[model samples]
Target: MRKTCLDMVYELAKADDRIVFIGSDLGAGTLSEMQKNMPERFFMEGVSEANIIGMAAGLAMDGFIPYVNTISTFITRRCYEQIAIDLCLHNLPVKLIANGGGLVYAPLGPTHLAIEDIAIMRSLPNMNIVSPSDAEEMKRFMNQSKEIKGPVYIRLAKGGDEIVSDPKNGFKFGESILIKDVGEVLIVSSGITTKEAIYASEELSKEGIKAGVLHMHTIKPFDYKSIIKYSQKVKLIVSVEEHIKNNGLGSAIGDVLNDNCYHKMPKLIKLGIPDQFPDKYGTQEDLLKYYSLDSKSIYESVLGFIKSKGLKAA
Candidate 1:
């Protein structure tokens, strides 16, 4: 997904003169072709993440849309003030390509894990958050990103994920894609977790349970209308995400349900990392399993929730 995003940036730059690429201590060959062809527009800065945010803001102010690349933790946690003041405050057309979002950097421990990136970025007023499910979705999102009017936080997962998205369904920023039709239960997810949600839905189907999958690639400017429309048809709503349960995708859905579906709110179960930092270090899959965010665990959780609520299959 990261490779597809940067490749699209290079492709976008080739067509638009106003597009610029900015990297903070990335690989020498990150965008070798773009750097070789457009040296003037491509910039590879040092380890200063905050400085790069300011630079991107300046470039955006000068009518150039800058695409900044860096680790998710560094770009967000290390430069919160700069992102809030420089990029989001002015609502610039800067795309923040955050690599290794969520627990992708789990081997490096809690400091490198971007478990709170979504919550952090969502707090900023003008910042938009997008977590594509896979490379295909990333391509679709990047192809249309230029039209968005403000700073965008493009959350990326580890590459080589399952291609669960269908082109026929279409792609639109700030809109939720209904991967499966409405059923007795709905699984709402973003980023790589959407794949797990799909798997869980299939597993539930095998047991005479009816479950649907709703992929919310764009977190901010969330598809509230879809949530309201779907929630009315389901007995339970399960929200799964890679980030923390607080103020992440689950929280966003909760807020929407509270404001719009007060009287007829469905039972919601938020599956994500807890508020506390992880104590062990391992692969992304290991952490996900530990937190019960894996496909099997998600299936079990949803099954348990349904049994507890006495929701019958349709």
Candidate 2:
């Protein structure tokens, strides 16, 4: 997914002279073609995340659309003030291509993990948050990202995720994609968690249960209409994300449910990382299992919720 995003940046730069690429302490060969071809537009900065946000802001002020790339934690946590003041406050046309979103860096421990990135970015005004499910979706998103007028936080998972996104569904920024129609339960998910939710929905189907999957690739400017539409038909709504439980995808959906579905709100279960830092070190998949965010765990949790609520297939 990260490669697709950077490659698309390079591709977009070829046609649009206003587009520029900035990398922070990345490898020498990260975007070799772009650096070799467009030397003036390609910038490889040091480990200064804060400075890069300011630099991108300046470039945006000068009518250049800068695309800054770096690890998610450093970009969001280390340079939050700059991001908020420089790009978001000005509503510049800068794109923040964040790598290693969620637990992709689980082996490196808490300092590197980006479990709260979504929540942090969502808080900033005029900042758009996008989490593509796979490489193909990233391509579709990057194609349209240039048209958005404000700053965008592109959350990228580790590469080689399952390609569950279909072009037939159509790609629109800030619009939720309904992978499966609403049934007895609706699984609202973003980023790679959508894959697990799809698997869980399939597993539930075999046991005489009907489940649906709604992929919210764009977090901010959420699709509240979709939640209200699906909530009316389902007995339960499950929001699954790779970030922490508070102020993340689930919380965004919860706000929508509270505001619009007051009379006919369905049961909502938020499945995500806990509030504390991880106590152990492992790969991304290992950490996902430890946090009970895997497919089997999601399936079991949904089934248990249904049984406890006495919800039958509709």
My TM-score estimates for the predictions, one after another, are 0.98, 0.98
Tens-place lDDT per residue, model 2, 125-212, is 9999999999999999999999999999999999888898998987899999999877888999998999999999999999878889
Model 1, span 45-156: residue lDDT tens: 9999999999999999999999999999999988899999998889999999999999898899988899999999999999999999999989999999998999999999
**lDDT, candidate 1, at 234:** 87
**Whole-model Cα lDDT per candidate?**
0.92, 0.93
Q: Candidate 2: where is the Cα deviation over 4 Å?
A: none
Q: Find the 10 residues in a row with the least total lDDT in model 1.
A: 305-314
